[model samples]
Target chain A: MELQQLDRYAKALIKEAGRKIRHSLTYELVIESKADANDLVTNMDKEIEQFFIEHIRKDYVGHAILGEEGFGDDLLSLNGYVWMLDPIDGTMNFIHQQRNFAISLGIFKDGIGVFGYIYDVMNDELYSAQKGHGAYLNDEPIPVLESTTISKAIIGMNASWVVPNRHIENEGLIRLVKDVRGIRSYGSAALELAYVSTGRIDAYMSMRLSPWDVAGGVVIAEEVGAVATNLKGQPLKFLGQDTFIVARKSLHDSLLANYITLK
Target chain B: MELQQLDRYAKALIKEAGRKIRHSLTYELVIESKADANDLVTNMDKEIEQFFIEHIRKDYVGHAILGEEGFGDDLLSLNGYVWMLDPIDGTMNFIHQQRNFAISLGIFKDGIGVFGYIYDVMNDELYSAQKGHGAYLNDEPIPVLESTTISKAIIGMNASWVVPNRHIENEGLIRLVKDVRGIRSYGSAALELAYVSTGRIDAYMSMRLSPWDVAGGVVIAEEVGAVATNLKGQPLKFLGQDTFIVARKSLHDSLLANYITLK
Candidate 1:
């Protein structure tokens, strides 16, 4: 029931996991592709996920954990204290560049996000938020998202979103891309959300993201006054994959009304 | 002229400028938009360009300079040692994010890129190459790019290139985007090119890039056995802006034959 204590524990756990992951970088990595060749999953990802699950089970025996690596429970509902964990977001970047990845963790109680933490493992930046306590990047408090028009705003997006596919209509996404100030893709959804909270980029859009991918970011983003929702301007589903866009209030509205209509 | 001496001096000068730029981040920045709202230029960009010019003029007189900030010579020919400089390659990112920008410098000997350096200022990573010697990432030798199939390669590209634009046909670029393993946009052509040299990304495509943006990258890319050329499969003009695609040999040909044909 104490949100502050829960937030503190989450941050420490994520940081410790980050340290362990970084230390293991020198060891030989066994990487394998999942789903497809582009969708890579390394042993590190599973290892870190198991590490979190073990700690959570040991510390909070009653809590439920949902993780990307399949080392946690498959809860039919997030009724009680649930921890959504993405041990190594941007695993491809970790395998190729060894940078631009993070450990994302979000804690929810009774279906409400009470604490969130995104740790940029290589950069040593911890973007964390406790409900009603606001967001902080490391020790400094992050400012609320500022209102900027589409023409003046920079966005975080992947190139696949603009390509014609089964998802949204590429024509509409292309138009949005043309009108924005700039587009950046760091290959990590969690870091992209942290960037939105920090004003590094004005917004973040992706056609498909898992619950674990956006869990930590949504909380941090909401704390910084950014709206997190699906392309249809609906609240994201916490149980599965969905289309997501997070931005300032005005920009979010404009994007949903004008560009995201075709989807 | 000793090429070794020139290469050593260029590396030192770029690294020094990088240190100065990082130090100036704390000071007040005078920012301005050029050409359009998104096209940004800052006083620090001009300051760094001027610094390079002053040093080049003082140390090696009569050398031609082609710099992004226009503090260099207006030359009709690369008939001597020419220094191509992009003081800050990602000006918008520099003003907003204070990171992801770099000081790019390339020394050409009578129209040939002899030495190249791309210094990621915030990360303190220097990607450099001397002609016939090898490419390097901060003293570690960088190996030549390995041939990769289009289906298994990650491409670095901006969203603008995939949209219906005045330059390329959107259909072809869209298809290419779909076919690639992954796509990334870092907002800096210089950094993207450096990534190509380092095998961080397999290819980098741009509709319009000035000589300074890819000069340093071109040299380093060549040292790593990656091909750098305009979309038409022709060598890039060293004197002005042009469309560019830098990739591994096989992927470069594949893109030109299938995707870049419409340009």
Candidate 2:
């Protein structure tokens, strides 16, 4: 399928998945555990993932689906058209707050991202892209970002990165926090990436994030002149967890070169 | 001035202030500083405050305006019909992100809160209340909260409270974080308080918040049966900083008794 066709379908699938999630907004949702209860897995998460998989199978039978919930195709190679989906990207946010979650999807053909979508379901925002057609919020055509310094940039990141913890030195993250223009943590990676695409946040960083957690956002983010990379300044993997930073091109080198060190 | 009249004026003024902010958002805003270069302030903050002050001075000349940016009246007490305003609450969010900030205003009559208004300009959401009449989003009357258990609640808070460095033990907050259903940090006090009032968040707590930050939110929060209190489970001082938690009365009590300890 053409990239634009994929984007159209992905956008539709995202909105449909959003409506399903929104229907559960007032329900007594069934909450469960995936990694742990703290790492929430709600019924809505499974339902939405299943919704995407069901639709993609019927509509694009040739496309392969990879999802966080164990409901999609298992693959060794991205040799064909593959769709990575994280139906409820912020399940904890969804379970607890009933908001701040998104429906995320990315379509790659032969390992090249051709389309992406992240919908802030409660807010009714849909961030969509068709590769080189550039990213968009709803219908507005968003353009590539211009330059801005780190001191003038508002960063979206959790403070957990800065304090003494697992991924990096707490002091390093704390100092980084003090150096930025402002810091915000929404606890929703898809929404934060969408915000970066929309210029609401200049950059975002997390000590560790998975492929499904950021694939759609990664595709959307690059369309806006931002860089998403591991702490070691290598390209982000589309298959595993890594310490990642999705930052402005201007600040990426400095953040990688000066601050980040392996634990 | 009559308390009812003040309520009416505050509602109108807040909506108008939201209008000015909405208009200003169309342009690229210049963000600067108030505390350090890192902490942001903006022209929109000044403009929004000036807009409210100009209207209040014309309508109720003697009513003192207590505000964040030093643009309002110098006052010892909220003795008269005092208009407490954070022209743009979450000024950092406003200056940098442009989405999470809000116009927060509260009218107190002889030390009793007569009315409160928090207008989310970008979202066009207005949360308002007059004493005894009930709180509202847009114009629909909001009901006092239904009870929710700790395991099912979503708490709104900044990580500063959860970390061990400043005041509390990291483990205490982590315990709270783990006990509660989920965590969210939206970066705006007024908005979060409004969320509490609307039942979007079961609770909101923070260690460092000034009077201007929670004054408007406290009023709205109170009307919806979300108890607003200091860490000691007492009424918050209207002058200095304190640990603030606005939650369903039951949840608020449970949090103070079970989770929070200043030491």
Candidate 3:
């Protein structure tokens, strides 16, 4: 299928999924934890994942799928048309606040991302991108990030990275927080990446994120002249959990060389 | 004047002021720094403060105001009807993102909070409270906060508190960030307080804020049974720059006893 057709279908499917989730907010939730107490997953998350899986399987049967909620196909490698999905990216926020969660989807043709979408469910804002056609927030085209140093740039980062954590050195993250113009934590990686695409924030970095968590955002960020890399200033592996940073080119390099130290 | 009358007037005035600020977003901004480079004051901030001063002086001539933009009265005592206004509570966010800033107003009579309103200008969310009456978010009555322990609560805190700041001990804040269910930094004090009032977040704390920043939020939060205090667990002085923490009764006490070390 063409990239434009795939992007159109992805947008429609995510919006429909968002509508279903919004209607489910009033019902009693069946909640469960994935990794630990703070790692939450709800029945609604599974339902949404299943919804996406059914739509994609029926419409694009040739495509392979990798999804967060175990509702999509198992894959050994990105050898063909693959769809990466995070059915509900911020499940903790979804369960606790009922806002700030998102549906993130990225389409890659033989490991090359062709389309991406991040839908802020409650706010009804859709951020999407097609390769070489540029990124957009809703219908408005997002501009490329302006040049700014770390001292003037606002970063989207969580406090979890600054305290004792397994992935990165805490001291470096602490100093980075103080050095930036400001730090913001919205608790949703997809939305944070979307913010970077729109220049609402200069950069977004997380200590550890899975392929689906960064897939949609990386595609969108790349279109707007931002670079995505792991803590060591290497390109994202798109394979599994790893330290990730999506920032403007110069700021990304400065953060990697000066502040971010991976443990 | 009656508290109801004052509340009505404050709501209308803030709505008008929000409209004006939103309209000014199209024009080129005249930005200047106050204390440091990150501390910004825009022409719109001054214009909005002037707008409030003019309306208050013309309509409620007997009332006094303490405004952030230095356009209102200055007094040592809060004896009569006094308005505490932060024309733009999150000025940095306003100048940069144009989204997260709010107009905060708290009306005091004889040194006690009588009416409060915090208007999220871009989102058009108005959080208001009249003393002895219930709090509201855009005419909908907000409920008193439900009980939650610190381990299960989400905190709205800035990163500045956790990294070598003057007000609170950095080590204490670092531990606190690790102890909470999660930490969020929205960069808007009024919106953070409003979130607590509406149960969107469980608590909000800041190491340093002026009276106008927390005044409107204090009254609204109080209506919902949340307590506001300094890090030392005393009532906020509402004088100049002071440390502030607003949370549920139990969480407030636990934070002071366990994590907060006043510097």
Candidate 4:
């Protein structure tokens, strides 16, 4: 299918899924823990992922899906049309605050990102992008990211990275936090990436993240002159969990060279 | 005047000030730094503070004003009716993101808080409280905060406290981050307090904050069964800069007793 056609169909499906999720909030959620207590999953997450799968399977038969919930297909490689979906990113936020969570989706063809969407459900803000077509927040076209120094940049990052963690040295992140103008953490990786795309924050970094957590944001951010990569300044394979950092081109280079010390 | 009468007038004035601020975003902001490059103040900050002062001076003849900008009176004591105002609580967020900032105001009589208001200008969320009449978000009455254990609680705090800062020891904060379910930083103290009042985040802490930053939030949060105090668990005088923390009653005790260790 054409990219624009796919964009429209996917956006409708995502919005429908968002409506379901929002409606579910009126009742109690059936919550469960995944990896740990902090990593939460809800009935809505599974339901939304399943809803997307059913539609995608009926509409686009050959397209595979890699979703956070186990409702989608498992594949070794991204060789065909693959839809990466985090039905509800920031589940803890969804379960706790009922806001700040988003439905994230990224479409890839032959291992390259083709379309990205992150719908902030509660706020009704849709951030999306198609490959080579620029990025957008709702209907407004998002501007490209401009270069900013660390001292003048507002960084979006969780507090976990600066504590003792296995992925990277804590000392470097501590220094980076001090050097930056300010730091903010919204508890949603996809929304943080959208923020970076729109320059609400100059960059967003995480010590570890699954492909589904960042797939949509990476595509949208890259369209606006931002670079998405591992902490080692290498391109993401989008197959598994990896350290993530997305920022403007110059700031990304500076952060990788001076601030980030990988384990 | 009566508390209810003052509440009606203050809400109208705050909403009007918020309208002026919303309109100001269309034009370019004249930004300047205070204390350091990271500490920003814009022309709108001064203008809005002046606007509030002019209205208060004209309408309420004898109210003492303690405003962020120097346009208001500088009184040592909160002897009579005192207005503590932070026209733009998160100036950096206002200048950088065009969101997350708020107009914070607290009215005190004889050094006791009688009324508080925090207006999230862009989002149009107004959180207000009168001493005995309870707290509200817009027209809805906010429920009192329910207790949650540290293991299941989400915390609101800047990453600065976890790094090497002069105000507190970093190790305790690092452990606290690990102990909590999650940590979030919105770069706005007043808004964080509003979030606490609404149970959006269980608690918010800052190593150091001026009275105007916490004045509005403290009143709102306290009315919703949240406790506001310094890191050492002392009451805030709302007279000067001090360490600040606000949380559900039980959580506040646990954080002070087990997590937060002052330098």
Cα-based lDDT for every prediction? 0.86, 0.78, 0.85, 0.89
Compare candidates 1 and 3 on DockQ and give the better one. Answer: 1
* Candidate 1, A116-218: lDDT as tens digits: 8899998999999988889999999998876889998899989788777788887787788888899999999999999889888998998888889989989
Q: What is the DockQ of each candidate?
A: 0.78, 0.37, 0.68, 0.79
Candidate 3, residues A1-263: lDDT per residue as tens digits?
57667777888899999888877663333233323323323777788888888988999988988899877777878888888999999987886777888999989888888888999998899999888989998998988887789898999998878877888887887789888889999999999999888887999999889888889989999999999988888877677788889998879888888888787
Which RMSD does model 2 reach against the true structure?
4.7
lDDT of 4 by residue, A32-104 (tens): 3223322333667887899999999999999999999888888899999999999999988887788899999
Which candidate, 2 or 4, would have the higher lDDT against the true structure?
A: 4
**How well is each residue in A1-263 modelled by candidate 2, as lDDT tens digits?**
56557667777778777776666553434343323433333666787788888888998988898898879887888878889888888776665457788888888888877787888888898887777778888888877887788778777777556456667766555556656776777878888999888777888888878777788888888988889888888987576668888887888888777667667
| Residue A47 in candidate 2, Cα distance off native in Å | 3.3
Worst 10 residues of 2 chain B by lDDT: B31-40
Better of 2 and 3 by DockQ: 3
Best by TM-score: 4
DockQ score, prediction 1? 0.78
| lDDT, candidate 2, B1-263, per-residue tens | 56667667677778788877776555323333223322324666777788888888998888888888789977777787777888888876775567788888878878788788888888888888887778988988887898988998888877656555565556666677767766667889999999889887889888878778888888888888889988888887676567788899879888888888776
